[model samples]
Target: MKRGWCFLLLWLLTPAWALAAELTGVRSRADAGNVRLVLDLSAPVKYKIFSLKNPYRLVVDIESTHTSKALSMPTTGMVKSVRAGKQQGGDLRVVFDLSSQVTPTSFLLKPQGAAGDRLVLDLGASTTPVKATTRSAGHQPQSKPKPQRSVVTRSVRDQPQRSVVIVIDPGHGGVDPGARGKNGVREKDVVLGISKELARLINKQPGMRAVLTRSDDRFIELSARRRMASKQHADLFLSIHANSFTNSKVRGSAVYALSQKGASSAAARALADKENAADLLGGVDLRGKPDLIKSVLMDLSQNATQESSLALAEKVLNGLSGVNKIHRNHVQTAGFVVLKSTSVPSVLVETAFISNPGEEKVLGSKKGQRKLASAIFKGVQDFVELDMALRLANAPSRPEISYEVRPGDTLSQVAQRYQVSLSRLRSVNSLRGDRLLVGKKLRIPTVAGI
Candidate 1:
């Protein structure tokens, strides 16, 4: 009763401008082509934006507002630093120091579910892509004929087969640091390290390449991450994140595929809520934000894609189980915003628990991080092999090679030597086990490779 009376007195005595508006949160997101800065406020207000040169800076001034001391000041991607302070004339001033010149755009967003009013500012690279500077003396660069056969001919024959593209996203960047461990192990940094390692492994594998949604410690909206994967024509969209909880004892790896229905369990629902709240923290209001969400029409094509995502999630979960303790023996189902691609098969992987002291140490080390990455790569490789086998079964018969099993050779070794999936090799040879007797003849499928 005493605390309540004090609060009432304070509220009554406070100035209207200070009580009516507040600069509650400030965060930034690095998009594929630009960076977005959002200011969370208690109420909407008229704002002003201006630019500065000489080392490049952007200044935002909001009239009649107070700010939270905990308001985030992000330094990621090209953003050098951010600072918020009171301006003369009783205005709130937020300044962004930039690494280079950038164009700024601003918008006002009304309150959304579980979120309040926000002011959004977008920064784009001021310097555009440079074109060819040197030109031939005779003329500008001439266009080659479509059917040209010259050495410089732009043709499919000159292009090697495109490798399978896998887009790896390191979750919770920019303003959202994700869950923090007792020892200050940040989920964003740890997952970025793991994602980079996984990309390296994936690139080293023959006939595969990797693209990272974010290559540095920065924030990216979930929608932007998904759009990037789709734009790259990715075969797989694998989002990497580290889990955390109040109970440090809860720890392990988990895999999730998006569910059309509600989450499979209560915990899954709660986890989804935490993840979906990322946009709010980053200052992105999903309500009336059409640019972030393209469409919600789940057609037959999307259904087929979701099915494939689930199958791949299962394979990845199996692979994760081999390297680390499985949080769930089966692939969990959740409505993760990151896994909402209409064409790409997507999954979210919780590499480990950052909140757990033991797991945090393991994830902090390079060796342990690589081990986790390798485990994820194995799962992805399995999914790719299974997908290829399905395609091969439907594809017209390709030429086959026959080889006799050499002495001391195992089926797994043979599969590796031929650069083919173990499952496909087993299917073609009709082998039930890894054991192979000497001099056994096998029909090798050339579908995976020649």
Candidate 2:
């Protein structure tokens, strides 16, 4: 009689101990452009993550974990399908079968009020090519040919290749030193170093390639940069730059994407105007012509590509948050003329503010450059995984569900209701203004904000 009572008591007490487990830090995202998993735990908790060969399923096991809160599997942003349940002995496990490949950015958030220690995971897009800068001596800078290359090339039937082309634009080259610091660090030099380091890292990754607008100290026109990407059929474009201000106290890195309508932020429009004026300094003809119409259409196409750009920017931003101060919580979008390429997903990363004396010293150092490069590389890796996940999710069929605009549906409010950032809402809807008036309609992209 005593032995039977003791056994029942032990079994009941085991679950209570398991329920007390607290999750500490979580630090893993897709690495090596492959669908990988990373997890940082608070204690020596038993867990396993592995893929099964037969039907391509990944299983994750966690010992002694139970919750009244529902266990939600990763959704179809960067994931195809997911299922979670408790196995025998009351252990927690999750199984995922990807249609293609999936890279997950996962972390654990501690209990706040009602919730217990929770895990958060972000799914990212497929990997594209890394941005590279080419310094070929014989590479010719050509004028726009009379017979323009076809904008759309149908190559779906061709064999898939690993090599991906990327264009890297080092902002403020030549006479344009961009933002200057009293501490003797030039914004142009800082950005160049980071860009070179990033290029080196990207090139090291297999099936990736990068090109630079200006290889040396020479100046390259903004228009020429876009032309170069189009000529090479570049998959992605990234422009590296450093920020500066009158006050040296401001610090942190910022990522910028192209904005089609309203400025990504108040400061973005100013930067765009300054960058667009670079051609004036180089004495390029800006007079009215029929070719300019094509340029306008190209700008519209750039808007469409912002989706990919935002994915890249978010991954990079998430990585940078670990090392440096994040300038903005979310990726910033703006009317950057340099990012106005139709087919390519383009972004401008303000690595740090050069005006700060401490940051200036760090930017000039080799170690700082490498750190920045590594963070950026991680961001790129995350982007690739997420991109692949998205492709796999959408491969089968399009999702259904639409939203008709209601009165007082401000961009911020709609974004909040949908649990997305305001910038994303604007990007998808092509809203010209941040303040939405009554009677406008917008499409909700995802089933839910994953």
Highest-TM-score candidate? 2
Model 1 over residues 1-450: C-alpha lDDT tens digits?
999999999999997666647888887889796887878888877665555443455666678777768555657667888777654346686767878766565566667688777776667776432111111112112232121111110111112343566889899987899999899888888898999899889868766667788877677887888777765556688999888888999989998888868898998888888887788878887756755564732341466677778778887887888878988888888888777754667888988889889999988888889999999998898666434322322334334657798988888766644445688888877889788888889876543243
lDDT on C-alpha atoms for all candidate structures: 0.72, 0.60
Q: Residue 32: error of model 2 in Å?
A: 29
Clash numbers, per candidate: 3, 18
**TM-score of each predicted structure versus truth:** 0.51, 0.53
| Model 1 segments more than 4 A misplaced | 1-161, 287-301, 389-450
* Model 1, residue pairs in steric clash: 173-219, 174-218, 174-219
